[model samples]
Target chain A: MTTLDATLDHPRGGSAAALLRHATALARRSLIKTARTPEALLDVTLQPVIFLLLFTYLFGGAISGGDRAGYLQFLLPGMLAQSLAMGGIALGQNLNADIEKGVFDRFRSLPVARSAPLVGAVAADIVRYLTVCVVMLGFGMLIGFRVQTGFVPALAAVGLSVAFGLCFCWISVWVGMLVRTPGAVQGLMFLLVFPLSFGSNVFVQTSTLPGWLQWFVHVNPITPLVSTIRGLLIGGPVASHLVVTLAWMAGLLLVFVPLALRGYARRA
Target chain B: MTDLVVRAEGLRKRFGKTQALDGVDLTMRRGTVLAVLGPNGAGKTTAVRVLATLLRPDAGSAFVAGIDVLKEPQRVRRRIGLTGQYASVDEDLTGTQNLVLIGQLLDLRTSDARRRAAELLEWFDLAEAAGRMAKTYSGGMRRRLDLAASLVGHPEVIFLDEPTTGLDPAKREDMWGVVRNQVTQGASVLLTTQYLEEADALADEIVVIDKGRVIAHDSPDGLKRRVGGLTLRVRPAEESRVPDVLRILDAVAAPGTSSSPDTAAGARPGAVSVPVTGDTALDIAVPALRRAGIEVTDLALHLPSLDEVFHSLTEGVPAKELV
Candidate 1:
């Protein structure tokens, strides 16, 4: 018989080192794909610029009772939370599109870890999170939203928001794996993110919300997340909300990471 | 059997009520092309998917390079590469990046991956488009990139699922050359194709499947011989005499099929043909036509093309009946 190539011939799932390598390689692929289609980044880049302007002008006066500067400070941190969540929908939509295009089938046939594609995809989405964070904060600060807590804490605030986003996008990844089409992924993620973004204290203080609506706002993970960002950026008590936000990020990773991996493995 | 690069037994998979694969077994020795020749929806892709470890069967044992495909799929994957029916290359990545990503995923270092990608791009004639996104390439170029990506690992076995299904004739011929080159490099190939001519040109052996079952398995010539060898065709001088020629041809051919002769059904103008067992049909018909005063413009006994072979295979008779 002819000799086979001196290949790895390793067991299923591969070793930890190999898994990390595969995931990183796939992450590189995701980044290159993102860079190739720079226009797809409009959701992360231009959308935040537009939304920050619109909301600051349109609702700033009404919500802050003509204290539009105060409203800008209040709205900026919440905008990070909302923008990052919306940014994740694009990740979900892209995953679904890749699945439909049979790109994942090629990945499946390769000798990589089963979770490599998902892990790589989620890791690459840090680009989106960073983009949304910078775009929102840059535009917000330009329009009179001050980071009262100084640059280090403000950097921490951006870091915290991006971390929360990185955790939250697992939901998008899982839904992307679960759905049949790219459009369906977009629609379903909106249905999930819409409630999470609006039903929380993302746009207003919890007390400002109607009493009945305030219950769900306190429970929504984005609420504590926004509160933590606000506490870091706008000089509020942060220790209690920080713990809850960290707990929520950990909880999301716990639930959706496995679900996303299993869905990726089992689904077409 | 021990030299076989791929072996599968009783590979059965069902998608709802449709049996995508039913008791399909196959084997391919090292350094040869094994064509899974079948019509659309005939379990060809299902069998390829199972063998490539992309889809698991309900009941089966499959091995690639002697590794259990289901239990040690990663080992199997290490030895095998697959290019699916659809363009599997990421449309958003440049051709060079796509191949390099696959090489890196296969554990090549960055420099080595880039080197391998460059070589493959050169080999596939994609060097000029290496920097362009795959979505910008034409269909033929995209298929070439997909095939090149699958080859990044220098796998021992390759699975090409309808690689030429949508390609033009020139492009299909290019694919055939690539398959032959891989075989020359000692890589065994399992090629699923709906084109009989492709199998004949490329495969050492062909397994013809229909309705989720292998109906015939043989070398291409053996398949044609089993379907009664050749067809006898006769063209009369006068178009009006086609019915007489059809009747004469039918009399000379065996009566395996109950297809009544039809003068109006001539696919070619003034020509009549029938599946004959061998060249004796020509010897028998020439003298008979001379005596019957039927002047013929053309009369020849030639091997049945795939259209005719397909006709006899799918004519409601079991393959064994024809054998």
Candidate 2:
């Protein structure tokens, strides 16, 4: 067959094969593009490592009262949550750039599934979120942060972190759609994420704060996520935190995914 | 007939207070290139967008490759390729990667996508630059790559909306060649352009739209015939002898046309223009001036051009009035 014949004559997929193939191909391209530009992972790699070093070494002594090494255990889990949360901004930044550059418009003109780019981008972020978690876990070990929960729960902890990251990605997609410029996305995301990161139970236990602040922190979605990761990493029953975190994930998917789909339908 | 790949009737679209497309109509046969010509803000891009399934029209209907665009945009999208006015390729990927990405999106197997990417790269003469990042490509290269990317899915109908807007003349010619190749291969092409010369040189059929409505549609020569008959121009060798050339022009076009002197002397020394009334009649109000007493440099008569037709049609009237 001629190249055109061979290309076009292929079975257009709605079958089981089609779904698997499209997803795998999209993820592969996303990974290849990311691998080609190692700089794309700088935030994913550096954020977790930086937090692990700064919070554990510098402030652990003052905050946890002389058990700085022991504090490593407490800080690593929170850093994982913060790392993945902050890394989610990459989604907004990249989406803004793609939209501005007309890449999304190009995709819209094609017969490809509209969800491919969105799904691919979020799926590719899976690697980024996982990488940050693994790097933090590795460096935490070097800095005297042991995983009291051992191996299986460590993997579960990373899974929870990545899932939370994916949930945040949906929110970021909405932000990316609303804010079409890359610089604007940077400004808006930083402004929104800074308060969410600091005002929650990320750096300290929420109960230590004032009553009103504690209430807000308790309701913060990241608090349940951080608490869940902490429980997973520290060897205890993480049932309630996991349940609450999963509920948040489900809630975000329920609300923001539809908004994202709407924005995507309009923007694309 | 089955040969008509695209048919639109009373297609209308409005954006807020502005009517972007007003009762636009078009028809294109299979294996032919129809160039849609209009000025900026005249809704050429909007028309293409509607046909490409990217936008929904407020009223009317369109069919592309036998599928109703509004009713089944997915099917229309499957049958047609669209190259928007801007370069719409993935800027972060290499040229080959961009093409392959579309191929994969079209559901090609991995090896098949790569092979198709290579083939398109070779066809567009981008093989050497295929591995380079698209961001580093020049405007012309990016445009060609965009066109190539559009073709990766083997779309039977292609909509090129102002595909050569920003390119230099040489690159524009290259794009014309690409469009020619597509039509020659039996792909129905609806090309939008503001450049009358591009339409004249490339279009098998021309549809001229002003504001949002199509004003004229025909072959280039046929459309040129409607505005005016023709013109005969005479040019004197010296500026001092311009009056002499005007006298000759007056002898020709003056009898029933107009005898305004200011209009007569307004003729440039190198040119005195007069309308061609018929095939062989030289009805000059004044005799050949150079033969009588004036020395002239050059004289000629020719049919009206698409440019003149466009200017006469669109000059003083706003596009909305035409609508």
Candidate 3:
């Protein structure tokens, strides 16, 4: 019979290395899973192309005073931003499914960083964000949206939107942990992203909205993200939204990372 | 350096209205498989989770692999691998991919992860279906994959929470072999199982827990010895002759021993068993039953099973044990 021992080296140092390894492993697995099954990124890829076709021809004359070029120019940034926001729901759905299937329990029992699963998931969604941006840009150019601010600023716009989308992914992780089923995640995320997408200027100009509604548009984080992308793509002095967008992204990450980590730590 | 690999002192945890763990104390040694046997919600899973560092105890402490789970949870996590009751591998990925993912999480290089994944797939006999999605695999196959994933890191201490609840007998034996393979490697295991024979076959030490407390803990043989030396159970073919059989058994069996009468008048009808005083006395009692005009259908003289011991220990305890 085995007896209890009193001595064994139980190293507790190097938590940063542990966390990094966990995050990278999570990201690699997610990327491979996406590669093996492309359905995860299909919505992010196809939605932007479809929106580019449906909106420019259908609403350009009515919304932009018959100036098709101006409508195409404004629609590209909003569509790209909306696509990233919509894809943020994927993280919540994936997490909810894992929780239901008891995969999270397996990870919970392991000796890794508590926040690794959520952090790894958030890290992987950055790749999804990049895929959506490239798809949106490629399709935007096919229809007639030109980037007047050159390649560097356009890349920066993509980076900012990706950052915002990643910050929102943490919020979804918390929501995912609260819900018991994957379908509930879809329902709640749709309710959240729809208002955040439409209440801002995704399809129409915020100036046309009533004064009370315009206040919400101005404060919405997605509003600044859309405006930042617009300023970067159209070459204008719109520095305030860019600064506010970065600040919001940083602030949300700061709050949600610890909150989501706490949620994960408490799980059975 | 005694071979103790697991030790806990007064482990306690509560979830609002329910006390999941009501101060459990347990111990196990190296190369030993200790079975924590309890009904559902008896803090079996909660105790494992505390030792695994997945859940913190509200009070008291536990030490796994010589590391305090509360003071140094990461160290405990490093030495332990846990396979939960359900299939926890990613179903969207293939069998090989799931093993590789766990290997990578342990910071193994890509080539090393693949090599280990390949080896595990072969060991679990899942190499033939390595490329198939885990979702498409049968329940037994998925459970095997989950077991294989836990071994990727080669942890010294393994916690298996009901490893064969939903498996066929053949598959359950296969899982038993996997566990034996671990023990052969000198790895310590804390297994929670409802299957009494599973505990008999695999456990070096058996801990019977009820209502979040360890009621009795000893070797499987030692626990059986608690009830008595031997039990003489007989089932006669004719229902009417059962009373004659019991009367003969009472006459031949030793005096002052507890005997369940086979009378249909009181309590359960036609269900009676009597415990003999000594293991050798059954030799004399068997022949006496044949002369009483009772056709014996089945008769056995053997040690008590874990189920009988459990029933006796929990007989008078409150039925609302989990709450």
Candidate 4:
């Protein structure tokens, strides 16, 4: 009989501790992957900045009644909200690509928590969301957009957007798990994200839209998130929009987290 | 009782209309290699997945390293490492980073994980490429890195699914050497492969499966004997001496075995082949042909190759006999 090496018998900690350790290890893997392939970060870094400059320069004058500065103030919050909504799609695409490459099978065979890969992937994506928020804010500052509600609320606004972004990614994770290909995940996410981002008040106010489209714009979850961020960064009502946005975040997590996990269990 | 590192009985799995595995049974003892040999879609990979606890069998029981796979899959996972068909290392991470990641996931401390990663990289001859991203490595290097990742935890059992399926012949041989080293280090391996030579080279026992069922299980030589014993080929120097050669072969050939007199007009025109029972046939035929005044160019004893055995076992035998 062959004897195994003593190093093979290293002690394993408790299950919860192991889960946290494994999730963190996987997160490190994602970060290394991002570092090596910085091109994957372009969506979060360049896309948001491009969208911010394009939307502000192209539509600011008309939307703010010839006052480009005032329009940028109104547009910055909505652009941040739109970027948050789009950030979840990157998580979906990454998950889908990992599945296609069969790395998830390797992860599944490990002595780690079943949810570690999903949770770790979504957690790692927070870095991308932060990058998008920073770039958007930094660019907005260059375009005469100021945070009127002081520094603490400005930080709070970024924190809220990230939290909402994390919650919304469960939907992307579920779609990624259910879909057959990364291309399909991209297409499906685009279909959902574009409608939610555009149909909301991200670009134009709800009252400016026709009556039929105004209903969707007013009720869209992105609308409350954008409204809440605007209230936090610039001068506006914060209480109702913040409450509704938090509720929407809670609702998304409640519905999509289990569904995504279940789908992963079946598919992976 | 001998210690069995892997055991599965009546394992069945289905994918909607396709029966991936039906009543498959396998056993592998400690520190030995068991090759599940089959063609594509023959349930070879399915069996590996079930025993590795990556997939649940529809109806059956499997145990790995004394842990029930279905009852406690996590326990089974702790005991097994699986190198899937596609090398599962993260493409964007460096080779060292990939191994370290797996080590950490296996619960090693940070320093220990780094030490083990370095150790495995050196052991697998990947030390030179340790700092390079896996995507930049060639297929063979990536595969070596993947195997090294699996060994970071020093699993008791390793499942290698077609480890050398797409590699060049030289790389395939390198992979075989690596697998041999793992088995020598006390890891029981369950390898799946469509290549017969791979099984013959590395496996102590080979299980032949087809259409989701275990058709035969035996040692390489044992399976070869089932199809036919050693083949004896005699080629006469002169075409006209073929009749005399045939007569010598007919006289000395083993009973109940077919002897072909080379009358066909293709390659080896003056050759005749006889299936003989054992080495004793060589003793009888060589002298008998000499006595008959027949000049022979070549007389050779050849064991049945795996290709012949596989063909006869898969296509010649009836389905009922496979069970």
Candidate 2 TM-score for chain A: 0.91
Please give the C-alpha DockQ score of model 2: 0.53
Candidate 2's displacement at residue B185, Å, is 1.1
| Candidate maximizing DockQ | 1
Q: What is the per-residue lDDT of model 3 for residues A1-268, given as tens digits with 9 covering 90 to 100?
A: 1322222232123668768887888877778778878877887898768877888988777888899888899888998888888888888888878877888877776666778888888899999899989999888888777999898999898888788888888878887877778788788988988898889988888889999999999888888888889999997666988888889899888998888777766666
Off-target runs (Cα >4 Å) in candidate 4 are A1-13, B229-307, B314-323
Q: What is the TM-score of chain A in candidate 4?
A: 0.93
Instruction: Supply the DockQ value of model 4.
Output: 0.65
Q: How do all the candidates rank in terms of lDDT, highest first?
A: 4, 1, 3, 2
Native-to-model Cα distance after best TM-score fit, residue B191 in candidate 1, in Å:
0.8
* TM-score quality measure for candidate 2: 0.86
Clashing pairs for predicted structure model 1, backbone only: none
Kindly report the interface RMSD of candidate 4, rounded to 1 decimal: 2.3
Report the lDDT tens digits of candidate 1 across residue range A166-262: 8999999999899898888899989988999889887777887788899899889989988889999999989999999999999999999999998
Q: What's the residue-level lDDT of B161 in candidate 4?
A: 95
TM-score of chain B of each: 0.81, 0.80, 0.82, 0.81
Measured against the true structure, the TM-scores of the candidates, in listed sequence, are 0.89, 0.86, 0.86, 0.89
The 10 consecutive residues of candidate 3 chain A with the worst lDDT sum are A3-12
Location of the lowest summed lDDT over 10 successive residues in candidate 1 chain B: B257-266
Indicate whether candidate 3 or candidate 4 has the larger DockQ: 4
lDDT of model 2 at residue A198? 86
Q: lDDT of candidate 1? A: 0.86
